[model samples]
Target chain A: MATVIVHKAGLLTMVQDRGRFGYQRYGMPVSGAMDVFSLELANLLVGNDPGDACLEATISGPELEFTGSTWIAITGAVWDPHLNGQGIPMNTAVDVRPGDRLGFRGLRSGCRTYIAFAGGIAVPSVMDSQSTYLRAGIGGFQGRGLIQGDELPLGTYNALLPGNELPPGEATDLLPSDGLTLGKAKRKPRRTKIPEGLIPEYKHEQTIRVISGPEVHYFELAGLRSFLSTEYTVTTKSDRMGYRLSGEPIKHKEGMTNIISAGISLGTVQVPGDGQPIILMADRQTSGGYARIANVITADFTLLAQMRPGDEIRFTETTLDRARLFCTDRHRVIFGI
Target chain B: MKEVTLKYIPSGDSAFIIKAGDVISEEVNLVVRKLLARFEEENIPGVTDFIPSYNELMVCYDPVTVDYRQLLGIFKKCAADLGAMTLPDAGVVHVPVLYGGEEGPDLHYVAEYNGLAEEDVIRIHSSADCLVYMLGFTPGFCYLGGMDKRIATPRQETPRLKIPAGSVGIAGEQTGIYPMESPGGWQLIGLTPLRLFNPDSKPEFLFNAGDYIRFYPIDKDEFEQIAAGVADGTYQVRRTQKIDNGDGNRT
Candidate 1:
């Protein structure tokens, strides 16, 4: 039973797992880590399950102090992580002792970063996921992001491994706390780095892949051409819920923008009456009334998730089968299956 | 068996939209519900969830376990044999609404816009049984269809910053309960005492797509009583069988 204390909660840091599923029919959005690839990679670096709960820090990262010795890995959004004033590298596992402080500076690239522990965050899962749905105020860290002075419980996923327990009163600052002890022998830390080739490149401008939405025909030829040709800039109002894009207004055929509200997914590019496109994300409502012009492909969602406001995005059409192949191929790369 | 034609449209690489008809109708919705029920019973591998709207049903699936062609084959087979499948009856829910005065805020405007008296507005809104076309926009939010066209009013020119949960509103031909606090443009006419959506509650949502809803007016005292009962976990919404009136009763 380990715990970590939060000193500064950062811009927005919330515990997130793979996602909440099998409940979308009940109007529950599958809130999860926006960038699944990075979340899973961080978890894998620390020997945790792919779906293990991790801290997703947005814009800025949280400042934390470990109450017990544990392993951690940071991935995504190139946040300058530091442990006791020592700069730490991203996508690599690192060990921290009791009373060791971990902090972050301004982000270098991307929008969200994931910090995973060897043993996942021990938060009660609501509807079978630790992911936080902020709008509903349910799941994750008491149904919200971490706050200053918050103590986050960490699970023990490696009980069978050699003990890392410590002796009594060894660390002067931390008292002999229950469920934790000072270790005698300092074991050499084990670390692993993700291959450079496997790391995704985050840039200011990106071309995302998409398949024509069910209502693609609702747009005229000129609108379709413009949608493909134009580069849409992410607006300032973008959040975990959705990204509002400002570009050439996609002209719809007369009386075509409005639709009977229907189910929406993670990457649905919905064009409303205003003609601007909104790409629904993790915290999006289960359904929407706007006509979906296209859906960003599954593999490209990781690329889209890392984008920040003021970034430009262009869409390229891909076939359904090809998109499925891209997704399977990415899974194979991540799981090595 | 109803003679309905369902067109399978690919919503995305990972989902399919089974369109029952071009327009929203009870018959089309019934077909969508039947397909959803059949898909649930079939327990198709890789199928994640089914969302049934007014005239279409969206089926989300895992691309890793299922491909577009294979999923289409399964859906096509289901559509072919859908006529023989028997589905359970949709639930009928009774919602008690407190219309007009402080709770609604926009009830008078709606009445004035429709050129009808406040009482006439309430009666017209409550007399007809509404269909829960879908649970969308928010958790437990029901998109209802059955507003008397004469009483229909346009939405507020400027949207309210925060519309309280359980607020009933009208936007064009549709009527709905907010279920949760959200910024909306709909012209609100009433507020329901029941908790339509609660994460802690069993079933979590009060209304599901395809459920029949009937709104009955309640006094403020009764609203307070129901609200207290709901807070204390003793309240239960009254439900009854919904009879269908033939020959263009509600389209």
Candidate 2:
């Protein structure tokens, strides 16, 4: 088995896959990569399945020493990643030799970054997922965040790469180009030669499209208007559990109070008694008592997850049809169809 | 035996909330869990997860795998079968608790707040077979129903920084057992010997929604002995089949 040694554990790093599924009945959270789009891209770049476990680093990233030769793709938040002191581009596969060190020394734009090894980050999966739920101490590496001296095992992957249409030295390689990903674009159902176009630009201020939540009617029209129109700054209290945004207080209707505790799906923008919108994320509780004024649509969920403390975000109401269209478009881009 | 209204509320684009009722009642919760049992037995693909809450069951699906409109249609059909569905027998879990003293830091306060003695509070709490409404906030933390109103107490003005695992607490009308250490405002009245959540063990959670918990007081010696056994994985959790009353309420 290949291994990646954690030289320096970043701010918050853990192994995550698609998420834990089919266990919500036990009140288990489906914890996975907060920005799953980047997770999938990282996996696909290394010829692994979308649900393959990988390293998810929040804000600051780790310094890893690879003990075996493997391909790795870094995605999501930009951290100005470096390989053995040489800079490497984000969203591109970089081949590493045995004993090569990979590290991210500085931040660029995003708050989270993903590094997918050739196969996957080998870890004992709880409830069929390697995602870490720190609150409950479930899943991932020792059911907790990565720390210094933690040696992560890597999974074995197949040699066949998807979109291997270009011959050797065909497309511009972010690093030295002579490997499996060289000729991978000209075949039927053509894959994009370079993934640069697909990478979303991380920004300080972004718009997150949302659909009305079940308790949206509980709020007054002014509250709804303010929610959509005002810029909500992500508070420092944000983590894998949820992001508490500080903005114009969304006023509820007179006599309207907290609803009976109901199910909270990912991206649920719940408004508590204080009237601030709390966007539930990957590690959110299965249920909550606060009223949900809106749910961030699946399309803009990744963008919402990338927002950092003090970063501004505005909610834009979108139709379900439009939300579906956006999700479909992203999938099409992923498959390069 | 009453027919409660079930409304299909769309939650974002990836899930649907099947609201069984506007209020939290046994009838509504039963309907929600009934729909869950029925929905689980279905062959619907793409619907990845189900969360049965106090008054609603949210079904999450992958829009890429199954069309949104098609899933909504499937859920509507599933909700239609609630009348024919019969709920499974409730599992009664006997939980051993060490009440008062250091184990229950707020037990005296609870009794004082309710104007009752601590022993009365314990007797009232342990006598009734409380229904497990749902589990959330933290893993294995159950939302309970059917607590004696005489023992009901308000939450602390300031929540403790860390409430230990296995701590039984009461807040407002709800009673809960913290599966793990978490910061909470609930008034701690006792500490349970059983581990509500053991991730390394099979059946990670001890109780589920639609189950029942009966708390029995134990002495400090018994608590320590049981805790040792639990730590070594030798403790057997006591469980029994809850005999149903004429009413369909699990309580």
lDDT of 1 by residue, B62-87 (tens): 77778888888888887788877655
Question: Per-residue CA lDDT of candidate 2, range A1-337, in tens?
Answer: 5588998998899988889987776788899999999888887776667767888999898999987666778889877888999998778778786678999876878888989876576677787778888877778889899999999877644333444422222122222223432222111223212357677788999988999999999999999999999999999999898999999999999867588888888899999878888999998888888888888888787787788999999889998899899998998789662
lDDT of 2 by residue, B38-133 (tens): 888896899888899888999998877777788878878877767866776788999999998888999999999899999999999999999998
DockQ of every predicted complex: 0.58, 0.66
**How would you encode candidate 1's per-residue C-alpha lDDT over A1-337 as one tens digit per residue?**
5689999999899999878887776678888999988998888777777777899998888999988777789999987789998999889888777898999886778888999886678788787788999988899999998999999987644333444333232243233222532121122223367876787899989999988998899998889988899999999989998999999999999999888778887689999988889999888888988999999887888789999999999989999889988989887887772
Query: What's the distance in Å from true for residue A181, model 1?
Result: 24
Superposed model 1: Cα runs more than 4 Å off: A161-191, B243-251
Local distance difference test, candidate 1: 0.82
lDDT of each: 0.82, 0.83
Deviating ranges (above 4 Å) for candidate 2: A159-194, B245-251
Supply candidate 2's per-residue lDDT for B30: 83
